[model samples]
Target: MIDSDILCDLILANKHKCKGGEVADYIPGLKNANRESFGVCLIDSNREVHCAGDYEEKFTIQSISKPLVLMLAILDNGEDFVFSKIGMEPTGDAFNSIQKLETSNLRKPFNPMINAGAIAVSSMISGASAEEKFNRVLDFIRKISENPTLDYDEEIYLGEKETGNRNRSMAYFMKNDGVIEGDVEEALDVYFRQCSIRVSAQDLARIGLFLANNGVTSSGERVVSEHTTRIVKSLMVTCGMYDGSGEFAVRVGIPAKSGVGGGILSLVPGRMGIGVYGPALDPKGNSIGGYAILEDLSKILSLSIF
Candidate 1:
């Protein structure tokens, strides 16, 4: 049996570790987060929830939205069609680096976990216009997380839109390469809105739980297919942490996706889903304190997939 008391103690013990990292400030709105905030939530297959610290506090979902978006795209367009647009390999470059696309002859984004591929996948979402596509994404997330009230943070969306020159460059490059279809701005709008979806740690945990159970809810309703969930988890293990994926795999030994907003959606396949939030981030944009706490929990609870 998992020890909820120990998990809470671990959170409290590791909360002070936030001093070692800084919050993501590139997206003007993300910089407004409290640097000291930390939270965690864990839900097992039985739907029992264990939480600690500020798990109730809401934050932007950020890049953690990538895997979810990828699943949606695969469901909409099928895997073969989607993979034809983006490569499955992990890029050693930063998530937003445009140089990788320039250096690669294929011009396809490395993986959906990165910004370029995510933008491409967003374009593939079934819709006639940007608004329709974004609404589809919003509905999917709400269904997966079981949170009817979840919505985008318009401030963050506009902030990302205003300061998204790099993303714009990537979209245009992909358009030139024929990797992305439709209007670049429209695709970017869907991407930005999806990333800006606001959720608390508990919401993420619930989403993770769905993934943990192979795309099924606690009530036994199937969301995504088992094949889709398997692919998503495999991608998370290989590329979920951006360039730091290998290190995360070595340390945590579970599939997880981290966001610039300091949220992590992790799962122990068939066991539990975990959500972590620490506004402070490491150089690679992962939650520093949150990572440490997960390491502790994985070790103490033998949660590693390996």
Candidate 2:
């Protein structure tokens, strides 16, 4: 792990990037975030932890939840069923863009990291009811993070539900195309709730550590299969940063997922898991200060897998 003093200095060095960025305003509940807020947590393969800034501040998981839900969906329905509805290729369009869905010959979303594909994947989680389905997703997250009290923010969930016109359009479109099989609202509900789940940067780091450890808990219990972890990390590399994934790879060179809420869940496979939060975002919805911090840390530690 990086030295604590060095970690703190890294955060202070990049904290100024927040001034040039914007907090996500499309979602009403996320608009009030402190624009200057920044934090990071890193947990290495030895179970050592290091943190700086406001690492314990809670925020919604947002799109960062996509890969986690994809894991559960795959566990419930075989990879054949899940991937049949969602393609593995990366998209060049914005994460929420609807253009490619119409252009693709199969009508499937380009990949699970985007909203359209995540919605499709969310519908595949098995349960007797919508509530049961959401509980299962929540349970999976809690188990993986080893945090039993994990929960979502109702205000964020309701706000997302109310303002999610674009997402609704995608869901209805997928429903019409048979990409989604059940009630559209039910599927959207699960997606919304998952996105609204709240966690601190430390919590996100712990989740990333779980992935870094190949889905095995610190106690040696396996929460996800090795094959599934590999697929998830690959997807993170290719699609996790929305259309910015390629640029992020060239710059930071780690598998990561970013949410519009300004949280990033990243891992250096077998080495460490990193969680970053900086509510100020660039045009692409990634945390500006957080990105700077990661880039600096990657260069300093030579953490890039490439």
Candidate 3:
């Protein structure tokens, strides 16, 4: 028996604790977000939803899409094949850092949670063209979230594509190393589009709920295999918060993935799924307010998997 009212009160009590962080400005469009905005949504095993603050606010999914896409890639092409292109280890460097890739003998991205590895995963998604591949991913996301109208934010997608020189370099490097097969631009296009998918806290909570149930929907249909869900959750626990993963695991004690757009999707294994949003980001690009809220909620609810 989870207490929805207590959760709402907790969010209101700690919303101001996130004032120290700044919004992500590197993306240009992400800079337009309201720094004070914060939202949270939680869905329990019984399908009950608890929401607080700006739960209805919409934002881009950003790097949080990595885990979902990683699961999709593994579903399309088994884990063994996907792991061959990207290592499962976390890189202590920044998520977009290419220096690590350049310096490593393996020349592979450290994990699917980072930019290089995600681009490699994007290339593996089955499709004849970039459009087809993107549509497939979009459809998958929509189905999992149970939101048929979910779609990408075109403005954010175009902005990212126009100002994505760093990502372009990563894609080309992976192509040269044979880690990514096919057109670099096409793969990048799919990656950017997936990152640009817009969702409210409710939508993200629904997606998290799907993962929490081991890829099963409330209707009991499995969208992804249990094995794939386990791998994705493990990656989220180990590398989902970029370089801040260790601290998050220590503080929150649950599997979570955060995006630069101030969204985090987290779950308490078989208990519930949580979605959080706050445009104010810590230096590591995680939602400051969102993190605080989750920390408080996890403590109160004893949601730690460990």
Candidate 4:
């Protein structure tokens, strides 16, 4: 096992060096975050947490919610039905880019982690009302975090709503393809709401623990099937970092996710779940410091399954 103290020191030591990177200023609400802020937490399969720096600080889940939402859609509808609406390939384009939509005759988006694909996944999550879908999404995060206080950041949600014209456009485009049957506005509402779910590094690590442990909660509770967990983790490894997915897989060598808010959640199956926060981002919209931290730990601890 990797010593908790070693990982703690690694994060603390490297944080100051990464402060010069850009934060996620594109999202209006994320612009207010401390660009120098950094945190890391490691959770075991038993849900035990070891953390350093600003691990208790709340931040939006951001794109990290994409995989779990995709998982939920599978639970709501079978995988075959879900993939028929969204392709599983990783694109080299930017997350919000519309190039693929325009250049290709393909009807659906490439994958769920991208903006267009997320909108498609948003429609598949079973629920009649926006509130119902939002609640179910929150409930799943809550169960994984084991934190009842987990709630949406309303300010973030509103900011995303105000600036989510592109997302709305994406939903509408998907709707035109018969990919989304319900109201476009309602689906976008759920997407933004899920993106706004607030969680701390500790909470995020706990959630990661479930994915690391094959859909079983730390307490041995089965939240999803083993097969479902496998599918979810595969997507995380292949498509979690927008256009940088392939590079992240080669560099980090673990199932991981990057959020626009400068967070990365990573896991080593049956070994450890990690949550990291560094508001300074790389060109790919991932936290520069967070990825470095995880890569170093993966090497030092030999945690890479590959």
All candidates' TM-scores? 0.98, 0.99, 0.98, 0.97
Please give the range of 10 consecutive residues that has the lowest summed lDDT in model 3: 1-10
* lDDT-best of 2 and 3: 2
Query: Can you write out model 1's per-residue Cα lDDT over 1-306, one digit (the tens) per residue?
Result: 677787789888998889888988989889999989999999998888999888999999999999999999999999999999998899888898888888887679988999999999999999999999999999999999999999999999999999999999999999998998788889999999999999999999999999989998877899889999999999999999889999999999999999999999999999989999999999998999889998998898899998
Better of 3 and 4 by lDDT: 3
lDDT tens readout by residue for model 2, 78-164: 888999999999988899999888988868899999999999999999988879999999999999888898999999999999999
**How many steric overlaps does candidate 3 have?**
0
Q: List per-prediction Cα lDDT, in the order shown.
A: 0.92, 0.93, 0.91, 0.84
Q: For model 3, state the Cα shift of residue 163 in Å.
A: 1.0
Q: Give, for candidate 4, the lowest lDDT window spanning 10 residues.
A: 98-107
Q: Quickly count the clashes in candidate 4.
A: 0
Candidate 2 TM-score, true structure as reference? 0.99
Model 3 lDDT per residue over 209-301, tens place: 999999999889999999899999999999999999999999999999999999999998888889999989988888989899899888888
Q: Return the top candidate by lDDT.
A: 2
Q: For residue 247, what is the lDDT in candidate 3?
A: 90
- RMSD of every prediction: 0.8, 0.7, 0.9, 1.2
Ranking by TM-score: 2, 1, 3, 4
Checking candidate 3 for backbone clashes, the offending pairs are none
